[model samples]
Target: MRKIERSRMMPIALYRYNLALPLAPFQWNMSQNHDFIQSAQRTISLERDSVDALLPRIGADFTLACELLLNCKGRVVVVGMGKSGHIGRKIAATLASTGTPSFFVHPAEASHGDMGMITKDDLVLALSNSGSTAEIVTLLPLIKRLGITLVSMTGNPESPLAKAAAVNLDASVEHEACSLNLAPTSSTTVSLVLGDALAIALLEARGFTAEDFAFSHPGGALGRRLLLKVENVMHVGEELPQVSPGTSLSGALLEMTRKGLGMTIILGDDGRLAGVFTDGDLRRTLDKGLDVRQVTIDQVMTVHGKTVRPDMLAAEALKIMDDHKINVLVVVDGNDRPVGVLHVHDLTRAGVI
Candidate 1:
């Protein structure tokens, strides 16, 4: 009887221990997930505060930095080390695309032989959060010797690099977003925002237009949209499907079939645009029991359909088509005479879509 009671009590104690063990691990997992979320939120909040801190700092020095870059006769050569180098490369590319000629040169490589890339006509833009990166500092004497203009973006305004620069744009941050307050987080964000501000200021000062930006990025979709004209992607000469307004619907269909444009332009005896017949029009005409052979195009054609100027941007022409739910447009001259036919496919082929 005594052994039976002891065995029963042992099982109850074992069960209780098993239940307690799971609770500990479950609780620990919940705490870990909470910590991860809290860490991320805290980091973002800190970085946001750091960027906000830069607003008051962007007064006289910011204007001076923009002025120097705007008046620069040659390219702006950017240099930095480590994470700052990565940000510098992006800033340089942005400046280059936005009307300012700029490029990045790694400080360590510049110390070796890449220094020759810099000339007296170029302005050197140095980036250093501490304002004392050895690799960048080592090149300052050489930059000065060449009589190159120096612009420094540094957290320490009184540091050697900043003191030597023609203008120092302060990029100081109170603390990093890292829990240990060591890794660069807030400082780099401030630097990138400041760099963008400088580039845009210069772009506005230079009166940079979309066409000028297109020229810089000719291989991109935006460039194609901005640079392509209706004339460049319109069906001209024999490719244009045209018929007299008095022509039979069957004859207009043949013209559309021959041109393969899914539409035909109806011109008057004086060669002025009178109407247009499309596949949609054919469907409507057939729905009305109109005879294709007996019906005149003028009876079923849409009069004075959407038209675009030959010199208008292909992108603008696309907007008209989208707005009007059209698949094609007639390219017209000053006299309202159809000179070319623009199909949606043409814009696609030209990469303007």
Candidate 2:
């Protein structure tokens, strides 16, 4: 037998012989994988084109729908069936988070007494690519009978659902991305993108600010940074490292060590902030051959150190420390009296850094 080098061997022989399995139906092949990839890319391209086609369709009717939802005194009730219902739930969430009050109600559920959720003040935003989903259409009469304002998003303008709506915004697409042209691929993408467009437009029009967004997302990092104040995270009372200007350098060092803040606030005779003595300042004093026992903190302290107000936001405090290349800040009152101490570690612990 002759020895064959691994690098010179052909994978075809291995695949044809050693890799062959007893289960014929579960055999691995490359040709089917290539075809699958090609089909997926073609579907994606078709869907992208479908979304592009929707851009030019935004006009008077789109404006009317937005105006209806914006001026609506009550919530915007999103209703749909099947695949459209899945998109409806996401749309409702986006609308609610971005300043508009909205929620989803399945058409089937609505038919089963969930119709009571809809009121005259509520705006019914219905979705159906076919424009005539049976369950959704079943609710149209009752929606109108309740005197609720209806806005229908459908591919066909002449759809019964569209005709019943006070405003019909066309979400039509050129074709389905599915190879068989049967699945709701491109059509659903168009609907979702249109829903996003509506949500952002309303968000901008309502003058929604970051603070308002923070109120709704209090548990998120952005909310913590924006809503948390200096007073909420600062070290107060005994936790604050402080020393009078006349205190010995050793006493100041003890205060810094006790509080574990690496610095101590130096107060003047009037009990207002006179300066700050930090580890860096101590190093310089030691380099100059100053005796720690004989020196007072005022002799080595840096005057007018960076400070923040107790009411200032923790985010602002972080920015101040970052810009100054420092790790700590003293929270002072209007009279320049030290009230609290904020360190980089505090900001990190509070999830603001």
Candidate 3:
């Protein structure tokens, strides 16, 4: 028993010594923290300067490049190597989605059987920081043989690729954001920004609108907001909860409950929209000590409440609801007849919310 107690105490003493060890090496000092922040800020500043330098280079060459792309009958074929390849893929995707047909073809793979993807009608956009990538330079002959138009984005304007291209947009940077000044940091950022500028320019030139963009991104929320109309999601025909203006408030409540839309439309004798009786109106009536069984719906109903046209975008209807602090809207025809009812819950279910 004495030996066991001594062994346990020995382990406990070792554990306490280990726990007491200083963690200062792992903790950042004020000077080290300042260095970290300065490193990030320096990278941002260098990249910003690189992009600013590109502004002056956007001259006749830039205009010619856009013209080539705008007039191309076939898709824009983008080619690049290394980091430029990644940027090329992104640029191609942006162009394709913005009404410019484009796709990325790896320079190395193009020399393989993938060169078949290029056609005489297509315009080739090549990216290389050094502008002399062996794979790209080797394909220049074949590109020319195909009679395809070539545009190049490169740092060295005098390099083989740039000299071969119909127009070269300079993407040079004085220094890289990397501490060693060797990584493709600033250069890649300039290329990306230049690509975005090209895409936006082409978009505006082609008169691309939000509706056109929605067609390209049909799976996203923006597409739903822009493409879906009021008639598409509204409750119409028999699903519409409505009663005559002479309906008792209690009868209107029954209709609202049966329709499960939290509101009921009150039509006039001429069968047009006279007013709307909603849950809020019921609350206001009760607050005034009015009897639901005795009061008529027209006495409490809101006259000519917010209405939307069947052709209006659901997003517009959502805005009206938000501005008025209401949750429902009545869809009406030109004659002010209630044709359908729209509830906020319906919009939420349709993902317009």
Candidate 4:
């Protein structure tokens, strides 16, 4: 059976209940896989256009907002209610990780006591779909009184929150993707895009590079690819399964079994990288002659083997494998010595693939 079939059935009420009818066979489950993506892509493209339209309007005030955030002594403080609150959290997180010190503050929580999280040295961004969310609008006066610069993102530019803002980036959208036109959809996408534009643009202006981004997201895919050194995850010491280049093919096979990596690194004279022998190589070797005792690793090892530096990112290693369409590689040092080997499976296990 295909992977799509193994998915649990969708709720009858949430979708058309007639399992016997109506869809391409492969789409029996996960109808949303392509359908929803197509729908969402429409909304994403629309929002992308909205942000693109915004570029021409990057006036003195927009520059001013950027300058204010750039000069802030503290983090960028984001606040909102409802769906906007959820989007606010993502924006805050993106900003914080991309070299801007930032975090989300729920307006409701702030009204009670969390208002203390905002300070005069901070730049505050407020989000509201209606420009009049009571929880958010109610707290606006206090934020203004605290002497922090206020930036509001709302679909309704004429609303109170926009009126209160020092700079209001128009996030207005024509309509939501929701059937009733009531739920947040396109509007939230535009808001999120705006927040991302701000964060990344500010990140660039501050000279924040990929290394800076890696520091904030060491656990993320790109961060792992760019920041994780081979030493941090490579097998070493007694865990290594390696053999000298002259070892018999059977001996190399034994090393592969003991190491459980489906392959073994072959070292050269003076302990340097020489070549590699894999299970695949053994199979090819057997095709010529089944006598392992008569063969040596040098007779079958791959002389021009793929290799990576110990200091390279795990992500880069995955890319090297993918670009070359290979399955395994040896980790080498500055002197071209095999320190370890990485397989496609290793990247999967390390969450780098």
- For each candidate, what TM-score against the reference? 0.88, 0.88, 0.88, 0.69
- Among the numbered candidates, top lDDT falls to 3
Q: Please give the distance, in angstroms, between residue 348's alpha carbon in candidate 2 and its true position after superposition.
A: 1.3
Per-candidate Cα RMSD to the true structure, in Å, reads 9.8, 9.1, 8.6, 11.9
Query: On residues 247-339, what C-alpha lDDT tens digit does candidate 3 reach at each position?
Result: 899999999999999999988899898999899998999999999999999999999799999999999999999999999999999999999
Model 1 misplacement above 4 A: 1-34
User: For model 1, how does the per-residue alpha-carbon lDDT over 168-262 read when each residue is reduced to its tens digit?
Assistant: 99999999999898999999999999889998999999999999999999999999999999999898998889999789999999889998989
lDDT of 2: 0.90
Error of 2 at 264 (Å): 0.9
lDDT of 4 by residue, 1-353 (tens): 22233225654443443453356557345543467777778777766766666667667766777887888898899998889999999999988888889999988999999998888898898999789999988888888888888988887879999999998877887667665778887788878888888888898999998888788877778777778766677777777788886798878888889889888888887889778877777788889876899788888888848899888887888788889878888888888887777778877877776
Q: After TM-score superposition, what is the CA distance of residue 160 in candidate 3 from its true location, in Å?
A: 0.8
- Please give the clash total of every predicted structure, in order: 0, 0, 0, 1
| Candidate 4 error regions (>4 Å) | 1-56, 81-87, 128-145, 154-165, 170-193, 207-227, 323-325
lDDT for model 4 comes to 0.81
